[model samples]
Target: MEEQSVVLVVDDVKTNVLIMRQCLKEMFQVWTADSGEECLRVAKQKPDIILLDVLMPGMDGYQVCRQLKADPETAEIPIIFVTAKDSDDDEQKGLEIGAVDYITKPIRPAIVRARVSTHIQLKQHSDKLKFMALHDQLTGLYNRHFLAERAAQSLSAMVRHQQELSIVMLDLDHFKKINDFNGHHIGDLVLQAVAKLLQDCFRKEDVVARMGGEEFVILMECGLDIAREKTEDVRQQLARLNPMGLEVTGSFGVVTANPQNAELSHLLVLADEAVYKAKADGRNCVVCYQDGAYLTVEHD
Candidate 1:
């Protein structure tokens, strides 16, 4: 089920807040704040739309709009000025300072609800388009472009904090045969199932993506030990999959980086090498590149 959008009402008058809340509560989850200061504070919770009263004792709506627009974190929130001042100049000023819409005092509940609904709909559409651009259509995992950009950002922070980072490259063993024998339809199901399991296995903070056909990558902000442990779990999970009477397994190549030395290109190359090693060591296993060489789990 889709969650209701949130609307924040920022007004000094308790009566005004109550009226707007009553009007919007059916369509949205409503939150109220008495002053611009409280509005900014509640903003961290990220409301979908804000209905702000222009006239107040401290920090007018225009001032709050200016501050919100200037901060990247809050800049995208749509603001509507609900004020007693219905002058053209007042409306012009509000619009110029980043208020998306304006509503005059002696409020009409229907109009307020309509405008808020429109803005929320637009925001939802915009967010959906952005997600589609960053994610794979088939697997619903992030695409290579988003993965590369996000991995770089994560690597930078890890470098600053002097932490370890691990990159894992995985390829389905004999994926083409699975597609050929089981047919493309069943192969697609296997891909989607694998994507879901990857999401389930990794921590929410980890970045996982599909790097085109039959290959995927995971960027973990953890040392080699933790990365290996998680990768082994994923390997076991994949081995357990029997899609359409065919066994499924994945070969994983993992590489670790220190704060001062992590480069995405280098890590990817090393991970690819390690995964190749896993395949050569007879698939369904993990090979980790650490301390200047590739290391694989030995069988007794």
Candidate 2:
């Protein structure tokens, strides 16, 4: 079952807060705040929509909306001004300052419910579209564009923090033979299973992306020895996984470096070369590139 969307009702009056809560209780999980200060602080709860009262003391709804819109962390949340201020200029100001909508006071529960539902639906649709743009359609992993963007951020971490980053390039050995024997449908299923394995093997903070086809890249914040061990784990697990009742194995190329000295692209090229050596030495093995040489990481 889908969870209820969170709605925050911000009104200085207890009665107004209760009324708005009653209006949205059936459709959303409602949170209430009596002041703009409290609203800004409670916004850490990350509500999906905010229904704000404009005429309140100690920072009006317009001020809260401006702060929210100015901060990238909260800017995307939809805001609706529910206020007694019915002047044309007031409504204009609310809308211009980033409120998705403006609802005048003497609140109608029906109108509030209708508008909230509509805006929430719009937000959900937009979020889904954004997810599609960033993710691989086949494996649900981060796509190439998303990887490049995230890699830029990781590169900054390397330069600013003197962080060591490990890059692993993985390719399925004889993947074409698997497809030629079983057909592309089975090949797709194999790819999905491998994608899940990669996700399971790495931490959430790690950057795991499917570059294309049977090739995938993983970026980890660690040194050479740790990366080689992690890469060995992936190789051992993939060898054991008889996904779809067929044997599946992968060749891994591990490269660990302080990325201030090398870009992400250079690391990938080095890893790709290691993967090539792994394939030539016979598949289903982990190879590490270190000290200007490739060494096969032997695993039991």
lDDT of predicted model 2: 0.91
Candidate 1: tens digits of C-alpha lDDT, residues 1-300: 889899999999999999999998888899999999999999988999999999998999999999999988899999999999999999999999999999998989999999999998998899899999999999999998898898888888887888778999999999999888778999999999899989999988898999999999999988899999889988988888775667889999988887546788888999999999999999999999988888996532
What lDDT score goes with residue 107 in model 1? 85
Could you give the C-alpha RMSD of every candidate to the true structure, in order shown?
A: 2.4, 1.9
Go through the candidates in order and give each one's C-alpha lDDT. 0.91, 0.91
Off by over 4 Å in 2: 70-72, 259-261
Instruction: Give per-model TM-scores.
Output: 0.90, 0.92
Q: Give candidate 1 regions above 4 Å deviation.
A: 1-3, 66-73, 243-246, 259-261
